[model samples]
Target: MAIQTIIVGTGRHIPAVIVPNSAFMHHQFHGPDHQPIDKPNEEILEQFEAITGIHERRYAPDDLLTSDMAFLAAEDALASSGIDRESLDGLIVAHNFGNVRPNAHRSDLVPSLAARVKARLGIRNPGAVAFDLVFGCPGWLQGVIQTDCMIRAGAARRVLVMGADTLSRVSDPHDRDSLIYADGAGAVILEGREGEPGEGILAHAARSDTFEHSTMLLMGPSYRDSAFLEAFFLKMEGRKLYRYALHHVAGAVKDCLDKAGVDLRTVAKVLIHQANLKMDEAILEALCRLAGLEGAPPGLMPMTISWLGNSSVATIPTMLDLILKGDLEGHAIRPGDTVVFASVGAGMNINAVVYRFPRS
Candidate 1:
């Protein structure tokens, strides 16, 4: 038997607040130059929806911080897997902005979100190391990859990885891209188990292009001039970012598939990051072309961006939780299925993992 790193359980926290496109109607939109946009709010929203396919998103309640959401998701994952919290060998939390309190411009990350989560879970084992990962949107997948390595190296047997982000608190309300921001959390438990070949994680790949694309997404002063000159908000070069993802993200996915020696046609599902509908579609097209497929088979990709918006790191894991629990209609992952998890974000980072469900 071979030791394989397999996901045992998953969970997600979808915030209750629903923010629709109309919610931005009264706000004045602006360009990166800090100049007011000439377009009307309705026209801008219509175009935004057509391009991003996000009609609404979720926001964490004012009282709940990013760590709080991660805790909730961790509880759910532990319960789902029925795994003892004390048995976890490590806890990894992934996020870009640390715990930013409501109406606060500064990030508070002194204790580390992973440490806070480990404490909240009441896991008293000092042997269970806790740490945070800040790898942009692909942070969560990166955590999973790290856990797999740890387990394979005999340094750990069980671990909990989470991705939680409160993008609403950091996004610029004055910028149209603010519509793409949301808040949520998701968690997964991975365990090393004796299993047969072709089980669990098969292969993975990652890349970063900081030389030319580092500023594709960065923090800057609010697009609309505010009295608080010291405050900064998340900003992005939307068109350039889109083009970059379309050009490179698919290549990363292909690299992972090749490493695993798996054919694209055999893939059952592609759990890609919920960045944008059109952009994801283009990436899929690019992947199919690179693999010599005419097009992506229908239902090959399951997405939650329309309602959940872009929850940064939480997107893929949350989508996985939904699918596993039968919450996502028209999607299911059965035994022995091959799936791909891929993401791209602020680091100008991209990663892909190929996994095969245990045959048992």
Candidate 2:
């Protein structure tokens, strides 16, 4: 019997602080003497907003940690889905940083978050187990695969898939890449159930070009050479990464669709990782060409990068939340639609999944 994982609910939580791009210019570009830089926050915000279509982004309060954001999103998802917390069988979080002590195993953050959720919701079940995956932007996709497998194996029936990160905390304020990173969380409830053929998670494909792993990296405090941390904070060979992601993600998307026996023409929309506006456009073009979808009508390309910037693993679900909020209301996506979820992240990892919306 083939097991199916259906998206029962989705939610996202952005922080209360709406940090406009101008805020970055004001704090980061100032001279050592506290003098204003030539470019004001308004000008920077205008440029970024125009290019990325993001006006502002929310940031976690100073005292709040990434796990808090994760719980926030989980609460929203459970409420919106009307799923009782007590019924949840497992929790899977994709996070790059945790509240745990340095050098401690990263998986420890899972139980900590699980405890908070259980306490807040007053749901105590021994089945509640938490685990963390640190795969940068591809973390959430990896979580989806793991959760799907677990549900299929009967290890879990209801799985909470969460992607949360506080990249800004580890970022270099002086770097543009750091300025673009923000903090937030997004989540979805994947329940074990069978969907009609060509629905739910039809197929998934992943690939990694290990030689390009260094293209994006984060060195932790445990490293003896603290200097590496200076370079590790969201550093990227932008051009190199853009080229690689376009080529690889495009291929992965097509491969997944092919394996699912679906044609590109049947794809209603492509929900890609909101890495950047330029990279997105390039990947869109490449996917069209590879799928022989040229001259096809334009598809939905909702982006959260302008405001949320690069949220690592949280980008996909956050964008999905934005979609649910009518961000692409005029777009052609509808029930029974075939969509592609694709991402390429820091590990030089590429993953793509094909799903069909349930018919209303």
Best by TM-score: 1
lDDT tens per residue, model 1, 290-325 = 999999999999989999999999999999999989
RMSD of each candidate relative to the true structure: 0.9, 4.7
Give, for candidate 1, the lowest lDDT window spanning 10 residues: 223-232
Flag regions of model 1 displaced more than 4 Å.
226-231
Candidate 2 residue pairs in clash (backbone atoms < 3 Å): 22-41
Could you say which candidate leads in lDDT?
Answer: 1
Please give each candidate's TM-score. Answer: 0.98, 0.85
> In terms of TM-score, how similar is model 2 to the real structure?
0.85
Local distance difference test, per candidate?
A: 0.94, 0.73
Off by over 4 Å in 2: 26-55, 100-119, 220-232, 325-333
